[model samples]
Target: MDEAARLGLVERYIAAYNRFDVDGMLALLAPGIRFENHAGGQLTAQADGIDGFRQLAEHAAALFREREQRVIARRSEAGRVVVEIAYRGVLAADIADGPKAGSVLEMTGRSEFAFADGKIGLIVDRS
Candidate 1:
């Protein structure tokens, strides 16, 4: 896809994510989509294919009462789109040893997007 179309697709995914709309987000993903989440230089979670991603997305929706991922910038790099993001979230439930409910989580992250047939195929998120 062209750069504009690619960016639009990614933006749509982000919009769905902020809305916690799993199906909306899934619609923009390729059937064989791969998702990876990284934190503190460690791989935290991942899902392969639409079914796996859907489960992950649904579970995540319950963790955050509110969340936003604003695009800071985006650029084409080596046949992929790299997006700089500013993220904020308010937890809806507490983890055993993690942040408490109602706590604000803030971070800056970047995501690398790989497209397959005009849909998002691979997403590698780092924070």
Candidate 2:
């Protein structure tokens, strides 16, 4: 697929994520999708297939009362579209020793996406 089309898929995924619509996000993923999340240089999450990804997305959605991610910049490389992201979310639940519920969490990150059969087959998110 072309870069624009790939970027469109990513945007739709982010929109679905912002709305906490797990189904909507899953609809754009390939059946064999692979997803990974890295925070502070540590591997924080991973899901190997669509089913696994759905579970991960659902769980994540439940943790945020409200969230948004905007694509601030983008570049295409080696069949992947990498985009700089700005993220902001209000926590819905507190962690044992982490930020409390209702606290606003903000961060800058980047997502790399690879498409297959017009759907996202791989996604790596780092922040």
Candidate 3:
């Protein structure tokens, strides 16, 4: 896809994620997409292929009642799109790893997207 199209796709993906629309998010990915999630400067989770991505999304949605990602900055370059993100969510369950239930969680993060065959092939996220 062209740069504008690619960036538009990324925007759609982020919107889907915020809406907790797993299928919508998967529609923008390549069949064999790979995703890595990093937090606290360490690799925290990974999902391969569409099905694996579905599982990951569902798991995350279960923890947050309402999650939103605001794109602070985004740019597409060198076959990848990098986005600086501000995330906010309402905790739906006690986070054994981070916060308590009923708490409002906020964080700053970045996601780098790589494309292949005009679809997202890999996504690496850091926070």
Candidate 4:
């Protein structure tokens, strides 16, 4: 895909995530997409396909109750898109019980996206 198309796809992915649109977000990933959160020690290794991506998204949504998540900045370079985001949200349940539930906490994180075929092929995130 051209650079413009790639950037547009990245924007769509962010929009879908902010809206908690699991299906929409998954649609913007390649079949063998890999998502990683280095700081959190989390990785969704080569989510087999779109179906697998959807499953991951569903599981993630069930863990957090996001009040708001916004992209503070985004830039594209060397065939990759980088985004800085600010998020405020609360856990859905107790950490030991299931998922931790508590007052909203603010977080800032950066995500790097590698685009291919007008979709995200790899995502590396850090806080």
Name the lDDT value of residue 8 in candidate 4: 86
Query: Pairing residues by index, what is the TM-score of model 1?
Result: 0.97
lDDT of 3 by residue, 45-126 (tens): 9999999999998999999889999999998779799999999999999977778888998899999999989899999999
Q: For candidate 2, lDDT tens digit of each residue in 3-55?
A: 88988898899999888889999899999999999999999999999999988
Residue pairs clashing in model 1 are: none
Output the worst ten-in-a-row residue range by lDDT, candidate 4: 39-48
Span of ten consecutive residues with least summed lDDT in model 3:
94-103
lDDT by residue for model 4 over 26-119, one digit each (tens)?
8888887877666565553435567766777787677677755578998888988888988777877566645358756688988898966767
Instruction: Give one digit per residue, the lDDT tens place, for model 1 in 1-127.
Output: 8888888999999999999999999999999999999999999999999999999999989999999999999998766889999999999999789899999999999999999998999999999
Better of 1 and 3 by TM-score: 1
Model 2 poorest ten-residue lDDT run:
2-11
TM per candidate? 0.97, 0.96, 0.95, 0.81
TM match of model 4 to true structure? 0.81
What's the number of clashes in each of the models? 0, 0, 0, 2
lDDT of each: 0.95, 0.93, 0.93, 0.76
Model 1 residue 42 lDDT?
Answer: 100
Task: In angstroms, give how far residue 96 of model 2 lies from its true place.
Answer: 1.7
The parts of candidate 3 lying over 4 Å away from their true place are: none
